[model samples]
Each structure stands twice: as structure tokens, then as C-alpha cells.
Target chain A: MREILRLIVVLSLICGISAGALTVARLNLASRIEKQSDFYVRGPALERLFGKPAEELLGNKISLPIGDHLYPIFYLTEGSEITELAVEAPGPGGYGGDIIVMIGLDLRENRMVGMEIIQHSETPGVGSRVEKASFRKQWQGLPVDEPVELTSQGGQIDAISGATYSSKAVVNGTNHIIDLIRRHRDDIMAVIKAKGE
Target chain B: MTLKQALVHGLWEDLPPFRLVLGLCPALAVTSSAENGLGMGLAATFVLVFSNMFISVLRKVIPDKVRIGSFIVVIATLVVLVEMIMKAYFFPLSQQLGIFIPLIVVNCIILGRAEAFASRNPVLLSMADGLSVGIGFTISLAVLGSIREILGAGTWFGWQVFGASFEPFEFMVKAPGAFICLGIILGLMNAYSRMRGETFIQT
Candidate 1:
């Protein structure tokens, strides 16, 4: 009976202490982890979209709260004029996991400038073929308000053979970015305007 | 045991995966590149040292019946802590090591020391043992990683070690290569020990 009591006491104490330490560490490092993950995971994709490395592009990042989540938007400027904006978001309904994509919007031209696949866990050689430059070429200079869907549905995107779900993920991801832009236009302009001041 | 003896014991006598024949999962899984292997080693080393020290301090208070449970709590917490730190500061290396960092919680070496050595030892001595064993593991992993990286990828720590024309042995960086390389190294070490008239692999 004493042994059982002691075991309970010791194990509880150990677990309690451990939980405290872990909580502290997690709280302290949470933001930095988020930043680092973004810098590494989405950095390359942003670089590809913006025609500059993420190190430079992220320097002018402007964030706005869209619904419950704060969306970080990176912008490129030509001297004082903001030339374009880049944003990455996870598109739902992917075959495997959330298909993350970074897209650039040309502020002056009102067109979709460029796009790069930020992350995905889709099946290789088939579903993963969405990453190919040939397929990705479809997005360059597309009008920002273009309805992004597959060709069979009367949209421009042609689903890669044996990869409808993954291709749909990219299409959905692009539309998601467009919706974010349309919804947050006022908030985005306010932030950019505030920065200009 | 003296601090020096505790430290030295892990370097050669209980060297992991080689001498102790333990921690082969990470040894095999994350050793595709030198940087990856080194990152994993350092992460495990961090867990091992801290967990050993904490367990040693609490040795008497932890009842024997639930000691394993206590050890696990400490080990798992430290693993999570290390994972957070890695994600924050060593983000690239952390990404490369990936799931292996969290999996350090189940690594036998940390628990092995807690059960076999730290449980009976003084706190300082236990810490010394932890550092020594961790360093040995780091060295073993780094060496294995180097051999595989150089031959398999024709690079060492991502630096080209061969002329451009030199074709890399694609097989050397694959899963089967880890097994073959580990086997050959183990055999060679055993041969060396036999030649020196010493004991066979001792845990």
C-alpha cells in the first residue's frame, strides 16, 4: 500500500514538473518557431514568385487579420511604389494534406503575376507533377479575378493525367488566394498605406 | 565512479550503435547526409544529458515500481523541449531531422543510462556519463554519415569531394546502404578488438 502511494506521488511529481518545463519552452519558442518555419518552408516559394530571395521579400511583409487567422503578405516595391504582393495559404481538399501555395499579385496590372508550390505531400510522379514548370506556366499573367478550375469544367487548368485531386488542390489554392485578396482588399490597402506613411 | 571514469567509459566501451549496439533507428533513418546525422546526434545528446541529470537527482524519490514511468515523463518532456528549440533556432537542421527529433523520446540510450547508470550514481557523475555517452553517439553518427554522404552523394557535408565526372553510387545513400555500411563497420571494429586481445562487444 505504501509502495503504491509512493509510486503515485513520484510519478505525478515527475509528470507535473515535466509538463511545466514543456509548457514554458513551448510558450517561449512558439512565435520564433512559426517565424522560422515560415522563413524556411515558404521562403523559397515567395522568392520564386517575387523575383527576389525571401530574405529581401520578407523585409516588407504586411500582415492583416483575415477572419480568425492573421495572414502575412509580402510585398515588393519599386522605390516607394508597391509593385506586387505575395501570400501563401493552405488550400483545403487536397488528396493527402493541405496544399500550400505562394502566389504573387501585380498591384498595377491587376493580374496574377507568378506562383510557386510552397509545400505538399502528394504522391510522387503523378500527384506531385503539379510542381512542374509546364503546369505552373498556366498561372503566369492570369487575371486576378479569373475563376480557377479545370478545363473539363470550362476553366483553363488541365488536370495532369492520374492527378485530378492534386491538380484540384493547386486550383483551389489559387482561388483561395484570390478570395483572400477580394475579401481583404480594404485591410491590405490600409496596411500598405500605413506603411507608405 | 570517478567523473573521469564515468565520462571515459562511454567513449569507447559503451559507444552507441557500435559498442552498445543500441539506437539503430535514428542511426539508420536520418543518416542519409552528414548534416542530418550530426543534427540528430546533437538533438539526442541534449535529451540524454538533461534527462540523465534530472533522473539522477530524483532517483531516490522515484519509487522503483514507477521509476520507468517517471523516466519516460522526463524523457518525453525534454524531447519536446528540444524539438521546440530546434524549430526556433536550428530550423533548417530541424526540418531535415524532422520526425526523428520527436522520436528521440523513445531512444533507448537515454532510458538505458537512466536505468543502468544514472539510477545508482551521483548527479554530477551521472551528468558526466550522459555527456560522454552522448558525444560517443554523436561521433559514431557523424562518421557513418560522412562515409555514406561522400560515397553516395559524392559530397561531404554538401561540399563536392570528387571531380564533376565522378558518378555517385546512388545505392550508398538508400536504405539498404545504411544496413550494409553499419554491418561492415561493425565487423571491422570487432576484428580490431579481436586483434588487440580485448573483450568482445560489451554493453
Candidate 2:
């Protein structure tokens, strides 16, 4: 009994100290990234392509309120134009889990600039192909005036070799973002304009 | 326990994954890349070592009836500390890890070790055990991550190993790949153990 008691005390102390040290390390890391990155986005890098700060323009904090979920937003100040919005969007319920992505939109051109997978929890050698630059580049310059559909749906984009589900998820997620942008187009423009004011 | 026992046990005999099968949550979650695996492993290691040491020291004072609750408190506190530090120091890695950092509080490995080992062992021995177990866990995650990264993305540790024409596997970076990879690794471990004339216990 005494031995058990001693063991507990020692473990608690060790946990306490280690946790404290980790907290310090994490804080340092965040600060460094903040110093380096021009802007932070809540969801995708689409806002960056537009030369606008997603976090600043969209106001997403560590946990920002999106339509329903909390998203982390970042921005690119240089590309804040109607034709360039780089934002990151997270596509949940992918083939494996969540597929995190960055989308670049050129509103002036009414098309996609590019797409990149920031992170994902997809299957290896199958679902993870969503991150491949080749797969992502397919979305570049895609007209946003119409719905972006996968080849399965007779769209311009081709589904990944073995990651049809994940590919579809990305298309769906991008389309959703486009819908949101269209719905809030004027509001977003106003916010962008007001920043200059 | 002796240092030799602590180290050896974690490497295989008492591995968090293959043997005890604890902390499978993050083990399967953040291991998409070698970087993530390393980050998660290091973070877990930090938590494991300290938690074991402290739990061993406080084993005497904590009440028996509330032992589980007390253990949780300690572990949660440690998790919070890790979360804050990761955010501050390793922002990119922390961002990659996302919510898994806080979720560490619920990791079975830490709690299991606290209950099974720290609750009965001496402080020094418990610390040794934690280090060994944490290292073993880290290695497992790294190996899994490397396999997934190499096959899925044609890259290892962000370096492109394959030729330009080599198409990367898309599914390997997803959650399903994690399970599949883990399953295969587990099977291999089972085979190796059996080959060595050891009893394979499925828990």
C-alpha cells in the first residue's frame, strides 16, 4: 500500500513538470510561425491568392466560427484582389477522415488559381494522392462561374488514380467554398475595400 | 525494476502499441508524415516521462478510491502544458498536430502507464520505464509514418525519393491507410514474436 502511494506522488510530479515544459515549447513555436507567415487562415489558402488576410479579413482566431464549424484562417496580403483569393478549406468526412486543403481563387477571372492539400488523414497510396501537385494543379484556372465537378460527373477535374472518394471530397469542399463566396460576395468585397479605407 | 528491464520492456516486451496496444488514437491520427510522427512522438514522450515520474512520487498520497480521478487530473494538467508549449515553440508542428495535442489527456498509454506502472514502481524506475515506453511508441509511429509517406506521396521526410514520373499513392495519406498500415505492422510483429518462440497474446 505504501509503495503504491509513493509511486503516485512521483508520477504526478513528473507529469506536472513535463506538461509545463511542453506548454512553453508550443508557445514559442506559434510565435515563430506568426513572425514568418504573412497571414494565417482559418480554413484554406484561398484568401492568400487574393492578397487578403483571411484571419484579419475574416476574423478567425485559434477557433474561429465558420458557418457551423470552428476554422483556422490565414491570408496573403499581396494577392488581395478580385482575381486572387488563396484560402484553406478543410473537407471533412473524406474517404479516410478530414482532408485539409488550400484553394486559390481568381474572382476577377471567375476561376480557380490552384489548390493544395495542407494535410489529410486519408489512406496511404490510395486516398492521399489528393496532396499531389499534379492532382491539385488540375483545379487551377477552373472556371468558377459553373460548378467544378469531377470527371465522374463529367467535369474538367479528374479523380485521383485510386482516391476517387478523397478527390470527390476535395471537389465538394471547393464547390462549397465557391457557393459561400458567391453568397457573401458583396460582403467580402466590402470587407476587403474597408481594409484599404 | 532495473534500467535494463525498463528499456528492454518498452522496446518489445511491453510496447505501448504491439504489446499493450495503448494510445492507438494519436498513433493512428497524426502519423501522416515523418515530421508529424516525430512531433507527436516527442510530445508524448515528454508527457510519458514526467507523468510516470510524478505519479510514482505521489503514489503514496493519492487516495485509493479516487485514484483514477487523480491520475486524470495529473495527466490533463500535463496535456495542457504540452499544448501550450507546442503552440508557442513549434507552431507549424503544433498546427499540423491540431487538436490531438489536447486529446493526449485521454491517451490510454499515459493513463495505463500511470495505473499499471507508476502506481506501483519507484520514482527512478518509473521514469526509466516511461522513457523507454515513450521511445518505443515514437519509433512505432515514425516507422508507420515513413511507410505511409513514402508510398503515398513518393517522399520521405519531405524529400522526393521517387522519380518525377512516379505517381504518388493518394490513399496512403488518409485515415484508412493508417489503420491498414497499423494492421500490417501488428501482423508482422505477431509473426516475428511467434518466430522467436514467444506466446502471442491478443489483447
**Highest DockQ model number:** 1
Candidate that scores best on lDDT: 1
Those runs of model 2 whose alpha carbons end farther than 4 Å from true positions after fitting are A1-197, B200-203
lDDT of 2 by residue, B1-86 (tens): 78789877898887867678888989888888988988898899999998898789888877776678778877877777776666
Q: Report the lDDT tens digits of candidate 1 across residue range B48-120.
A: 9999999999998988878898888899998998888887999888767766887898899889999999999
The reply for model 1, stretches above 4 Å from the true place, is A1-12, A30-42, A53-55, A77-83, A92-100, A107-111, A117-176
lDDT of 2 by residue, A1-197 (tens): 87777667755665576567656666666655544332332333534344444455454222334568643433334555543455555776688676776666665667777776766667656887787778877887888666788888888889977778899888877876676566766665555566555
User: How close to the true structure is residue A158 of candidate 2, measured as C-alpha lDDT?
Assistant: 90
lDDT of 2 at B142: 90
lDDT score of residue A113 within candidate 1: 77
Model 2, position B200: C-alpha lDDT score? 51
lDDT of each: 0.85, 0.75
Q: TM-score of B chain for each model? A: 0.97, 0.96
DockQ of each: 0.64, 0.14
User: For model 2, what is the error of residue B8's alpha carbon versus the real structure, in angstroms, after optimal superposition?
Assistant: 2.1
